[model samples]
Target: MQTSNDIRTPAEIYDELFVPALFQQWAAVVLDAAKINPSSKVLDVACGTGVLALAAAGRVGTGGKVSALDASPEMLGVARRKSVRIEWHEGVAESLPFEDNTFDAVVSQFGIMFFRDRIAALKEMMRVLRRGGSLAVAVCDSLDHSPGYSTFAKLLERLFGTPVADAFRAPFVLGNPETLLSLCNDAGIENAQVRQHSGQVRFASIASLVSTERACAWTLGGMLDDQQFEELSREAELALQPFAGENGDIAFEMPALIITAHRP
Candidate 1:
């Protein structure tokens, strides 16, 4: 509990901050689409802090098996502390450390976009899934679909220039359904069904959003000094006011694409 040099990893920060703000709401949707059942054996790929893994584990219950895989040891460490029953493996998505035709369902939530080689990862997901086993994945939609993030990106580009702020664009790079389906085809995964899903973005206020960004958003946070950040927050508030309610609550719609397929 006491540490001077124990730096918090991105996985730790993601589990504590972004999970509630974003990932938790989508985990069930992903697992449900994968059709995880009490007797199913499940695997969550790129399972940052194991949100989807935990949800699948609950659905699978005592009779089922659940394994969580991530490229980050830090992330796996965080996941292990939360659940010991499920197996945790540190590995990349492109080359899963598992045997072929082993899982009933393989699921990933908001993690497909970050894979270094999405096509290879897709193949690996298929490789590990048994015949007729399902694969379900969710990825954030384009920037325009998320008002708060769009405004923040506008601000980021203004402050840091387009090239740097473009890093923020990575998550939405595969937002298109056509692109998703095409990638699966190229990867030799067949009959993938791609569909859009809408969800809500919620924060107590614009200030709360700004504060969270400052504290945890690595890409754009800490680049500006205190005074500049405060000014940026003020500007962001004005820009986001249309979505703010009378009680000053911030809420907006966010879209994502969910892709599902089964092995031949």
Candidate 2:
């Protein structure tokens, strides 16, 4: 099973390392919020490696249909290899390639913060949703809401300055409920509900936690040089000790704001 020719891309590393630790657990939560039925036509926007889409396909069974779209072809490549039943598309969130009133449920997880036009993306999600169909979106809660990451951010600042710390903090930019609700309103989405759902950020070790973020483009990828990465790793081993278990596993509460709405 081991070979010198085996080279895993960054997307593959993301799917392999990040999905199970951070994202896979949220699939059911998203599907539940969207009320995925056995025959429901579901669309997963910014589907990443298709964790949510794979789960949706399972829920829909043979009669239902599940389609996933992401901006990354590399990610879509990994997702396609995992399952052949679900439809996979490579596209941006703001301009979804689907007909209006086509989907019974639309869901996105932790992808809204990075969208070029968040309001346009939400509007597109709504536009493609049939009347009375459900939409669920999940985004990381603010850095302030997560003490572990708050500490980690400060550590990054100590080691690499504010820009690097800010890079680490980008995903939490949409953590504020008011800001997210305002986005919904701006997008003309009626009666959108935003609720904070507590979750855990776990890694095999402090090293795993730090290394994953190092490789993640969403976090600190391409920002740290080799020495800087080593410095951060050395610092993080102690800085993140509070959340580490006896087995050296890292665990902390990292809540997310889940926004749910229906097309009226």
Candidate 3:
């Protein structure tokens, strides 16, 4: 169950496993939702490993600028190695370091759920947007909506306990569309549009899926020890087998609620 990966930090695990499995594809979706274009100044808040920021940089080309911020120096360190074109800042979502009207577009992919004050963060994102600019945010859809994770949650509950399952369910906290809309309204975001977009999750194998989740602090980290992870991996082989393809790859629908708003 344990391997050389056990020594790696959560951010390293996230950048190596979770980003490719879950986040990389969504980066393009977020940038597209924000309508990123050449010459646009962009900021990616809570940018883990600079996936979205790096994509925005390529989309904007040399004519534009991309800056990314996250609270974790560990995560920023991983992101910094990926590209020098982006301005990586270590900061919290609730208080951005940039000045007002600084960016043509601002985005956060799967980071809103952990913010201490969601409304404050939203306001800060809006405050940094130029007029006619856009803000696009993505949060996981409810666990119920994601069939793979729904079953995984049940599996965790049966095997580990409700507390362990609940930790896995934390990312889906803001999955409700109405609740997300209400939060945007409370933040005074104008003309916000919330839409559900289906995304794909892939892992080399069921054990790969379970092990990566074990390493992710955003999910099962600290909740599982070596024995627990080994047990979960054994069970996941059978529990998550339905998602396995002929080649033994695991794939599932991991949808997200994308909220987009344009400043008038």
Give the candidate number with the greatest TM-score.
3
TM-score of each: 0.90, 0.96, 0.98
lDDT, candidate 2, equals 0.91
Off by over 4 Å in 1: 1-9, 214-218, 221-228
What order do candidates take by lDDT, descending? 3, 2, 1
lDDT digits (tens) for residues 149-263 of candidate 3:
8889999999989999999999999999899999999999859999999998998888888888888887788889887877888888888888899999999999999999988
Least accurate 10 contiguous residues by lDDT in model 2: 1-10
Q: Model 3: which residue pairs collide?
A: none
Instruction: Give per-residue CA lDDT, model 2, range 101-192, as digits (tens).
Output: 99999999999999999999999999999999999999999999888899999999998899999999999999999999999999998699
Clashes counted in candidate 3 amount to 0
- The lDDT leader among the candidates is 3
lDDT (CA) per prediction: 0.84, 0.91, 0.92
TM-score rank, highest first?
3, 2, 1
**Model 2 error, position 47 (Å):** 0.4
Output candidate 1 Cα RMSD: 3.1
